[model samples]
Target chain A: MSYKQVIYTTAPDPAIDPSLTTGTFRLNTVPKPTNVPADKLLVRTHYLSLDPAMRQWLTAKRSYIAPVEIGAVMRGQSIAQIITVGSDLSSTFQPGDWVVAYSGWQEYAVLGAKEVEKVVLPPGGRPTDAMSVLGMTGLTAYFGMTEVGYPKEGDTVVVSGAAGATGMVAGQIAKIKGAKRVVGLAGSREKCDFLVRELGFDAAINYKDADWRKQLKEATPEYIDVFFDNTGGEILDACLARAARDARFVICGAISQYNAAKPQGPASFMTVISQRVTMKGFIVFDYAKKYPTALQELASWLSQGKLKRKEHIVPGGIEGAPQALVDLYKGVNTGKMMVEVAPVSEALNAKL
Target chain B: MSYKQVIYTTAPDPAIDPSLTTGTFRLNTVPKPTNVPADKLLVRTHYLSLDPAMRQWLTAKRSYIAPVEIGAVMRGQSIAQIITVGSDLSSTFQPGDWVVAYSGWQEYAVLGAKEVEKVVLPPGGRPTDAMSVLGMTGLTAYFGMTEVGYPKEGDTVVVSGAAGATGMVAGQIAKIKGAKRVVGLAGSREKCDFLVRELGFDAAINYKDADWRKQLKEATPEYIDVFFDNTGGEILDACLARAARDARFVICGAISQYNAAKPQGPASFMTVISQRVTMKGFIVFDYAKKYPTALQELASWLSQGKLKRKEHIVPGGIEGAPQALVDLYKGVNTGKMMVEVAPVSEALNAKL
Candidate 1:
């Protein structure tokens, strides 16, 4: 069988601005991966998670993970359906099982058992949630907040990029954890409205406004206690300026600077010293051992109607993955940006 | 009785380069503070500690501590001898007892009993050591290393401002803690030599050299596991680039940016995210409870000749305190920089 795949062709030019063209990835028709080795399973991609980390994966620079090699399928995480299982791993993963895996930007992947996690969603939970709130995004918010941010009751928590996938969930979690105030910094007025009106953020500041700094100060009257920083640039500097004494600034993601030809540091970083703040940069993979507990709690919150889930699903299967990533960088998505290659069964959609 | 004191007259112009004139402090002669209130002890300053923080105190801007008001004595830490004890506190302190106190840039000060800690130097220890290796500098190094930096055995620990008060002690502590390669960044070849020869740093790079960054990379070939950053600016950016995975950056000071009109933030701060680093800025006051333990351990090290002590003592009484601070900012001092206002008794000086 033939399937579609996105192949990385060349490294991006850092001198030029990052865009769809910066990714040098091309869609190609390829034979579906077959000959599953012993202890491996053959899976078909259903939904591909379009994340900001994809930008880093395309760069030649060393990061937490290696750069995707040229002529290889673009690296990505996907919700997949097991098509065939090798005899060695037949008991662990049988045909028809739905799982989340590091399946890359390809329709079909032959993955070892360890590469995929069998995602068991609750009743009425969508498999797509596993790619968003129930998977890496939600878990990233959970551990980064509890472990690094260390929010306390009556603390004023400020989150940058608060309308994005991890940011929205992080603010909600801060609110749920008894934070006195949860202020969000988003780009658009609509996203700000969604955060405060729909997502329970105490207040939201439109960072694109000329007086966003003033808005941030007005919103966080008592100063910030825990700062969940997703966008790292001027917004981060503004947040740093208002940081309370001994504030914890969790460096979850720096989406704003990821594409910059020369990423400028926060100008108000002096507050990190004046306020004696702890700024920690972390990767969610560092907390892999605690993912189960985080997932269970997130699932509980979702079932109880305490947590909301949203996804901006792009069409065109594997061909849309690259463009969806560009849209993510442009802040066009309100929630988890994903490319849906194959739809789930009507029964599964109805359950959700 | 007449006494000499330095008074801050105005805030400095950040746009102008900082000099002795930048600090609008004037030496004044006034009647000694003779009326020791109940619960207070009158102290005659012996060694006035001139710290980089004194520069911040001169500014009207908000910091960890309140700014020294115009016409008020310049704020400083000092080693002093009890001159006259108030009857109410006669049991706690007596004349001729040596202590460390927030005596400011003055010849005499009336301080409450709680404002000072009695200095009980080890046998054969100099009273000046109380203002350096066995005092706040040592304490800053101890907690910033053990609590924040958390240098492990065989870890490459890099320290900036290698020959300064806190940096020297911090690097030595890293060595004492069994760090594999302890590298230092200093301003001059002499300071670098002192750090390597006298202070036991594995390697010392003169940051004033044209190829300092390259030297840093070479000195820390395996990259830095822990970075004790004292000089934050371009040197900090260079160090951040060589940070190892999960490196801990203890932000003890930013001496390099203290005088800048607009301190530039470190450009390579994204390395914090890529390397999963924890950069923490701390004030020594936060670890007040642990001072006794730190002091005892540091004293033990000094007594056993494990830790070396160096002091750049500026003479000419309390009048020199202002100029000594300017010298501190200029990186003229090799170790602790202090102004010796009054001569210590012949008996105390003999102990050196």
Candidate 2:
């Protein structure tokens, strides 16, 4: 018997093909492993996350992480269920244990025990939260906002890509942390409405609207004190123009300009000097030592229903992973976007 | 008797006229003051400081400060001598006392006693040092380099506009603060040579050279850890590209883009995220409470001959103020550029 796995077929120049059908990736069937290594475990992937950062991993350029090489398994994080425990780790690990790992776009993975993080779900957290709210996505939002943005109580916080996974979480975190007025920039009216109506954002601007720039000006009458930028383009320029004195810009992701051969910087960047603003960029991994403290607070907010999460989970397993990633860049998904690679077995006694 | 004063005659849009012949300003003949108000002192301008920030005052645009209004004496800082003291200020200010005041581009000014800061020359400091190293130019470099850049002992520092008053001081401060290497970006070969041989920079790159970017790359082989940027353009982009992890960018001034209607942002600004860089902008006035501490240290360095200052004095008095300002934007001045309005009165008891 064989198992399916997606392989990166080409390293795109400047930008990856947003439409994955251009032969940039190939779904290959590989023979199933007959045995697990003594220090490893055999696991079956349940859900594979689709993220904007995946675009950077497709190019042979220097970034936070190395690019996924051609003919290699596409890099991704996934929630998996342990199918077998290695002989050397039978006492510590058991079959049916749920763990989150870099299982990539594959049905099955053979991984060392240290390569996988055992998932002990907090209260109100579902299994999917391991790949969404309680995982890297939540951690990115947490550190990027609290540590870098440093939003004061009276700060008017503006979040771009507000309907997406990390962005929605960042905006919600801002509101929970006592931001005065939370404004969101989304790509569509539905997302904007969802941000305001469902997520408790004070206002939402659909960047697609013709009068979007005007709307931004009106929304930020006091000027933006804290800006958590996920998309960097004209929206970044507009935000820079209205930046309050000593505004803090948390540079998280530039989803809008990721595909451009020559990305344009914000035209109003000089405002950084005029307004005495500070722009800082950071990676979530930098705060790994403090993750427990952050997660404890995030879990409390989630358990109290103060923090809510929205997910756009794509079904049809690994085959849909490519298009799901493509759609991620297109802003087609609201909140966390992931592909359901497989279903958990009834025998797995996990509570979540 | 009449006095000559330069008045802003017209406001230019997009970009200011680098040529004073464009009639943006006019030399006006005004009557000499007959009397000083009770709270004012009649002053004779001696030395007028010309700065790149003057360009911002030429346009009717919002900035850190209000623009110079049409028909007003063009705003400037000058060292002046008290010629006559008002009755109310007679006890506090004596004739021939030297002071630094915003006396503008005029041969004489009637200023409030509070408007002028009495110039008490420090040991081994000359009268010109009041407007150069010990004045706003030096203060800007002090806080901007120390507080904003935070150059570490092993850090590789880079300074753009490194030949200018503020930039040269910032680079030296970085060296004094124990930076491992200091690289300077200058416009001309002469300026570049002066930065290395005269000011003791580790290396200097002439940005006007065709292979300047390559030179910058070679000079900062360890990568730029602290970048004090005074000129914002391709130079900023190059520094961003060569930025080391967790680099600090002190955005002091953008003389290169000051004249542009649409100032371009750094194209490689994404490196801010990739390398976790921090870019902060500031005004020297914000640190007014700490000015005494900064000035004391600067004066100490000056007295020990550790800190050096170079001034390009245009000898043709107030009549040349307009063209001197135009030449300033062209980067013709190597260090602190000032116009000598009049000879300091020998009656002044101020120490040299």
Candidate 3:
């Protein structure tokens, strides 16, 4: 019997094109392991997450975490099912249990019990929610907005990459936190409309438009009090120019510059001194201790329909993940991008 | 009698050359005023303070304060002596009393009592202390370092424009507040040595050197915990590359970019995210209500010799003021730059 896993090969050529023969990643077939260690379990991957931060992981440079080494299984997070339990773990043994783990891009993985976190679904929540709104993405939006951005009542809040997973939730959170007006920036008219009509954003601007800068200026009449930036290029520069006195800039990610060989900084960065702004950057993992309490609130909001979810799930198994990731850089997904490697029917049957 | 005042004539031609026949400013002869209003006092200018921030005031753009209008007396701060007291302010102000005011560049002026702050010298403190370490420049360093930078014990601090008025004090304050090592960046070897030897900086790098970046790296083995930036250009970019995690960047002045037709930002600014850095900008006047307590503490430090003062006084009177202003942009002064418009004989005589 055999299992398949994606292996990292070459580094990015400024921008990633996974279809090339000498691309950054390639799929490899390997013999399935027949043995599970006494303290380990064998699991089958059901869904694998694809995110913008994964691009940062491909570069051969130092960051919050180490870059994925060549010839290694590509790094990832996924929902998986227990296929077998170890003999020494009989007390806590579980087959057919659903859990989340950093299992990488593979069909099956052998892991110790401590390596996976058992998923306990909230009322009216789905298993996929654990990989998104009730998981790291949701937690990032919660902490970045409330803790770093500090959007106040009546403050004009602006968010870039507003249609993406973390940004969508961050924009909605600003609204729930009592911001007077919330504006979102996206790459297309449909995404803009979806943000305004579906996500309840007060206004949404298509940054790809020729008059986008002017549109941004008109949208932020009182100026941006809180700017949650995920795309760090021209949009960040424009926002910096329109920053109000004592504005707070929460730099969550820089998706726009991730592919560039040499990323450019905002030209209006000097406005920081003139306007007395505070620009801070953070990684979501820093708030690990507060995850549980945050998930409860996120789950509550999802149940109440105050928060919404959009999943762009591809279904051709692990093979589709690399192309999906490449499409992500092109703004191809409306929301969270994921690849379904195996049938989630077991969890769905249990839910019923 | 006619008194001289430097008049702002034209906007900067990218850079100011006060010697230009058609320049940013010109010396104008004005007839001396013969009358003093009941609510105003006549004062003779002694020493006028020149600062980098004055350049920002020359541009016809909206900022924290209105720009100096064309054909107006170039704005300045000065230590002056009251020549005659207003009828209404006789008890509050009298002849021979030394005071500080935004009295502009001129020999004499009439001002309401409210326009000037009374100067009360601390024990063993010189009257010039009011123009440097005990004045606005000192307050800028205090509030910016303590409230913004928040340098912790066992931390490394780096300061640019390290020999200037605010940066010198800011670097010393970091030391007094218990920073383990302090580094200073200046344009000349002499300024660097003065900083390391006389100002107690642990290391001083002359930024004009070809290997200054290598010197900076060798100086900060622990990386920069706090960066008090006074010159914002390539120096800022260099500091950003060596920033420690959670470093605090106090954005004070950007003298390097003050005259650029198009100021460039730090190319390595993305490190703010990778390192979870916090960069904040502030103005000293924002803490006006707390000035009294700040001044008392600063005076105590000066009396104890924990804080030092240095002044570069130009002595050809008001005529020397224009070229002095031009030389400021060239980093001519090692410390606080000022012009001695009139003798301090009256204040000195009163002390006897």
Candidate 4:
């Protein structure tokens, strides 16, 4: 059996908003290889992970990691099945076994046995759910807060892009970690409502509001003690103004400024001096070594029914992929923004 | 016998460009130590230390430390002679012993014994030299480089305000630490020449040039690995733009921005994310405990004549103090700005 691979085909991205992710994957049908090379395994992709970082990876610039070349399939974390295996890469399963691999943006791929970890799915869900709240997005929020944010009890915690996968989980984590107030800044009223009503955020401020700065201060009267900033730019500047003494500003993502012609600088940096603030930027993949612990904690919270997972699943094989990528930058998707290839059950679709 | 104490008095500081300075400090002194109690120590001030941080202290707002209140005798670091040590608070020093203390513009002061620390003269130099080359300024150069800059052997270290007291020393230290290139950024062609010819800086760029930004890039081809910034504002913004990966930007002082009604924020701070830079503001006083080690090392450097001590001393008694500070803010001072209340030697005659 053979499958298709989405590839970066052109460099005609608009200079103003230069992420022209057009979905038209290169499809190929060839006989499956029977003789695998040493340390090679066949992976039947169960779910493909889609993230905004994929856009950055499309360009061959000096990003946290190298971008995907024009001819290669885009890079991502994937869950797959073992269709066949060679003797050297053979494990427990003879021909059929469920496994998680990082063979990205493809229906099926060949991966080295050591290249991917077998994610034993939780009792409540499938692998697609594991790719989100129970996976990297959840872990990114987990370590960013506990390690970088380090919010103490009664500390005011602020999160940017609040209704997104990471922000939603981060704000809730801060609350669970005994934050006195957890304020979130989002782009729209719907996200604001989701943050406050669903995620238990103490307050949510739409950054689109001109009075957002005032609302932010009001939401955080004591000033923010720890700011888990996923989206940087004016919101980061506003947070800088209201940062309490010794506030921790974690730079998880700068989604707001990433696509601009000239990136936004921190305007009120003098506040960092007056407030003795510490701002640190990190790549989520750098902390991949600690994901198991992060996943364990997130899974426990999910299993206890204390945590919620919401994903905006976009369907179609690889045709909707490019639009999904463009829509992500526009903040069109409501939640985790996953592209589904195969379905689990129709009853599981009821939540959507 | 009662000797009339001399008090420096300025009618008021005349305004220059408000953008360059918030305002000038008028050194007004009342009757000095006329009511010195029997248990108090009457100390005669000899030398006053002038620094950029002093300008910030004179402003009526919070900085890293509390601002000096208006109408109080302008605060300064002065090396003074204990004229009369009263019986009540006497132990560490006797009358006539030289000591270092925060004695302002007045020629004589009634100080508590606890307010003075006896100046232990080193083997080779006069005590007032202690305030610049071997005192707080030297320590500022030390910690700002070692703790913050952390320049590796092959890394290029750039120091702004490069001909100033701290900057000159910081560049030498970076060279001593085996830096590949040490570049200096100064305000004049003469200062740039002096930095390159006299100080051993690899290249010197005059920030006064119309095309200084281009000159800076030329001087530092690979980009600055460690930026020891004293002059902030546009210079800081430029440095941020030219920073290398994992650059350390140690903001010792922002003399250029200090007087501005609104501090200019960095235009290219997003470079911090791209370059993985870390910018931090630090005051030398916080590292006061390391003064001994810093002093010992600097004293050795001075004795060997490896370190140069250039004092732009004003000739007068306490009356010259206010104008000396004004000249510093005007960038008129050649090197370490200081006010001589009395002569250092026979060649430096007593103006009084």
Candidate 5:
């Protein structure tokens, strides 16, 4: 049997220079492994999650984790299915069970027990919700608000890239958690309106607005309490200047400055002191253990019509992974971006 | 008897373009206050403490507190004495009982109990320690370090403006708290030695050095657990980048950036998220109630030879107020800078 995977031609270099994003993704074919053991199964990929955090893997440097080596498979979370089992084992991962796995952007990935956490889809929702509203991105918003952002009722909470996967959920979650005025800042007017109308945000500001900072100041006269920052750089610095006393700044990503050769610093940092604010960062991987609780709660909200789940699906195959991610970075994808691999097969199932 | 009180006038609208350091200081005469109550005492100013924070009062805009109104007396702490008693309650007042007052840049003033807090000097030594070690500046360092910085034994700590009043005592407190390495960032070469050698800091880095950032990285390779920052621009930014996970950055005073019409903004904040650091601003006025405990601890340390005190005294009446404060702004004075308004009656008595 043959498995198609998104293989790496060159790892991200240390400089974070232009070469890192020099279309570093590629597709390759690899031979299937031997027969799976009784406790293992093969998973045929249905979806591959693309995120900005993956950029960190491309660089070889002293970071929170080891960098992805050159010519290795790119790591990611995906929704996949068990096609074939080598032997009858625990019922948790029986064939046809739709599950979430760290299966990378690959077609036929092999896995052992506990390698994937099965996604229990709601009555009417698709499996993609597991990767968006109920997966790592969902947990990122959940914990980022609870532990870092410290959301409070009637508080002015601003979120950057408000239409992106994480930002949308983060804004909605802030509103759900009783933020009185949830301000969404996105690149396009459509995304801004979508944030305000579709997600129950109190207001939406376009980052492209020439007077966005002045508008933000007028909108939040008392200053912002929590800033769920995804797109860092100038806007993040603007929010810092407008932060109220004891404000909480949650840094989930800095996409606006991430791809640059030299990341731009904050434009006004004395506010961090003058305003008595707190800024902290966390990784969703750090909160992996809490996924079960997050998934259950999110699924409950989704089924009860309290939350909206969105997914941007890309056709699965070895060739589409690179452009799929590129489209994601371009802000083309609305929700959790995924790629469908092959029809459920015995070869893929045996490794699940 | 008639007396003329002196006041330093603001050079009518003193607005520094923020890109430059040049400023003007002026002196003017004030009419003596004609009202005096039974409980209110007439304070003949002695030594007027000139703190770097005075720069804020010269401006006409809003800051942490309202900037000193033009034509209004400046706001500050002054060591003074009772000149005349209005009531027959001789038991309540002597011709000269030394006290601390917030009478601003004036030679004669009337203050109620709320304006004055009595000083109980040490039995064996000069009472100057009250202004430098047990005063607001000393207490500022004390509570700012223990409460905000929270240094633990064996933890490395870096204090910016390390030879200034607050930083000087802040580093000493870190040492007393059992910090393994107390690193200091001071302005001059002599201050660097004064910090590490005389104050027993494990390391000292002169921020004036061209390779200061490199020296900071080398001196604190293990990362600093606590950063007691009095200077908050580039040095603070550099330390923020090199901060270890869970490091605490306490913003006691951003002296380096305070006088700027608009601070040049913090330049290296990405590390705040990457390192999960915490930074907070504080004012000594907020911790006024806890001064007794802080003063008690610091006074005991001074008595036990565990801490040293320093003061830069400028002699003259209220006419010297503007120049004294201007000298402080130029970093001309070391330790606590004060203008000797009049001889403390007790000091003269002791000399007699």
Candidate 6:
């Protein structure tokens, strides 16, 4: 069998430009592995998650995670179906079982049983949800808000990149936790409107608007108690300027700075001291032990309709992974951005 | 009776110049406050604490504490000897009692019983010790290290402004708490020597040295775990680059930025996200409730010789307050910087 894969070809010169292109990654066809190791399972990708962190992975510098080396299949997390199980792990995973795996930007992936997690989906739920709201993005928002942001009752919580996957969920969670007002900042007016109308945010400021700072000031009249920052740049500075005493800034991701030739530091950073604020940066994987409890609460919220999930699905299979990531860096996605590789088997869907 | 007082005449233009000058202050003789209010006591100032926070108080901006209004006495925390007490508070304080008071840059002050704290000295201890080792500076170092920094037994702790009032005490406290390596950054080689030899810091880097960054890299071989930052500028950026995962940055004071017209933000601030670090800014006032216990522990350390105290005593009494403040900003002092406004009364010394 033949499977399509995206491979990292070159590291971008952060000093010159950091635009993602086919020159940096190449599409290739390769023969699928014929024999799986006894402890491994073979997964056929259905959905691949395209996140801002992928841009960081393409760089040569050391970060929280290792860089995607040249000539290597690009790294990503995906929801895949176990097409075949090795004899040693046949009792653990069976054919047609859906799992969340670090399957990378490829149509097929071979993984050890420990590398993939079994997805326990709700009735009538799609497997794609397991790669988004019930997976890494949702868990990122969960721990970043509750643990780091520590939004208190009657507090005003401000979320940047509010229309994105994690921002949308983080704002809603703050509201559910009794935040008096939840304000959001998005790149476009339509996304801002979606955040306010669809996600039930108190107010949404279009960062693209010339009067966005004024809008943010007007939206958060009492100053922000917790700022869940995903886009860290001018928006982060504006938020810092209006931080109340002892405000908590949860730095989940800096999507705005990810693609910059030289990431500009926030000018109003001194507000971290002047306002006696606490800014904490964290990764979702750090709280792996607490994932089960987080998922249970998230699942309950989904069932009760207290939480809403959104995903922007790109139509092309594994070959479209590069453009999907490029579009993500351009702030083109409204919610979770994912590339659909294939449809899950009816048997797997029915079993879930 | 008459006493001399320093009054703020004008605010400094931080953009043009932030040097402390007598041009912004004037010394004048004033009648000593005599009639104590029903709940107040009359106190004679002895040792006036000149801190970096005083520079912030001169600026007409909102901070953790209100700025000193122009034409008002310069605000400060001081060790004073109570001279008389109101009838209502006679039971709580006596005439010869030493107390820590918000006495400002003056020889005499009238304060409410609730506004002043009685100083309890160890046997054979001088009243001057109360202003340095067993007072606000000591308390600040205690809480900022234990509460915010939360150093572990084998943690690599870095302290900036390592020879200042709070920094000296903070570094020692980290050492006493069993930190495996305590590295310090000071402005001069003498201060660095004092930190390493006198205060027992494992290593000290003279930030004024041409190769300070190289020295810091060599000193903190395992990267910093808990960074008690007192000076925030390039030193902070250098430290951020070498921070360990989940490192704690206790922002006690930004003495470097205190004088800047526009403080420069750290360029490597993204390390906060890349390393999953937590930077917390705090004021000593927040831990007021726990001061007594901190003082008890500090007093015990002082008596046991586990902690050493040093004070740069500027002479010329109250008339020298302005110059003393300027010298402080110039980094002329080694440890606690204070102006010796008045000598303790012979009667008070005999009573103790």
Most DockQ-accurate candidate: 2
Q: Provide the lDDT at A129 for model 5.
A: 76
Indicate whether candidate 1 or candidate 5 has the larger DockQ. 1
| Candidate-wise lDDT, in order | 0.85, 0.88, 0.88, 0.74, 0.75, 0.86
Quality class of the docking in candidate 3, CAPRI style: medium
Candidate 3 residue-wise lDDT, A115-218, digit = tens: 78888777787777788888878888999999999899999999999998888999999999999999999999999999999999999999999999999999
Give per-residue CA lDDT, model 4, range B1-352, as digits (tens): 3222322222223232222123343334356455568667888777888887765665524466776655566677788777777766666567667777777666777877667777765567777766777777778888889887889999999999888888988998898888999999988888888888888899999888999999888888898899998888789899888888778888777778655666667766656656667776666767788878878887887788777767777777666665666677667765678888865442223321
Using TM-score as the measure, what is the rank order of every candidate, best first?
Answer: 2, 3, 1, 6, 5, 4
Report the lDDT of model 3 for residue B279.
Answer: 89
Estimate, for each residue in A1-352, the C-alpha lDDT of model 2 and write its tens digit: 7899898987666555534457578888999899888889988898998888888777725577888888899999999888888999898888988888888889999998887888877776888887788899999999999999978999999999999999999999999999999999999999999999999999999999999999999999899999999998889899999999999999998898887889888878778998999999898999999999988888888888888999998988798888888789899999999898886544366455
Model 1's A-chain: what TM-score? 0.94
TM (chain A), candidate 6: 0.95
Report how far residue A118 has shifted in candidate 2, in Å.
1.5
DockQ category of candidate 2 = high
- The DockQ scores of all candidates, in the order shown, are 0.68, 0.81, 0.74, 0.34, 0.50, 0.56
> How high is each candidate's TM-score?
0.94, 0.97, 0.97, 0.82, 0.89, 0.93
What is the full ranking by DockQ, best candidate first? 2, 3, 1, 6, 5, 4
Tell me which residue pairs clash in candidate 1.
none
Candidate 5 chain B weakest lDDT stretch, 10 residues? B12-21
> Which pairs of residues collide in candidate 2?
none
Clashing pairs in 6: none
Cα lDDT tens digits for candidate 2, B1-352: 7899988887766555534557578888899989888899998888999998888777725468888888899999998888899999988998888889889999999999678988877787777788989999999999999999999999999999999999999999999999999999998999999999999999999988999999998998889999999999888898999989999999998888887878898888788898999999898999999989999999999888789999999997788887788788888999999999986544366444
Arrange candidates by lDDT, descending.
Answer: 2, 3, 6, 1, 5, 4
Model 3 chain A is weakest, by summed lDDT over 10 consecutive residues, at A343-352
Which is the better candidate, 1 or 6, if ranked by lDDT? Answer: 6
* Per-residue accuracy of model 5 over B189-300 as CA lDDT, tens digit each: 8888877778788889878799998999999979889999887777777887788877888988777766665565455555666667777777777777888888888888
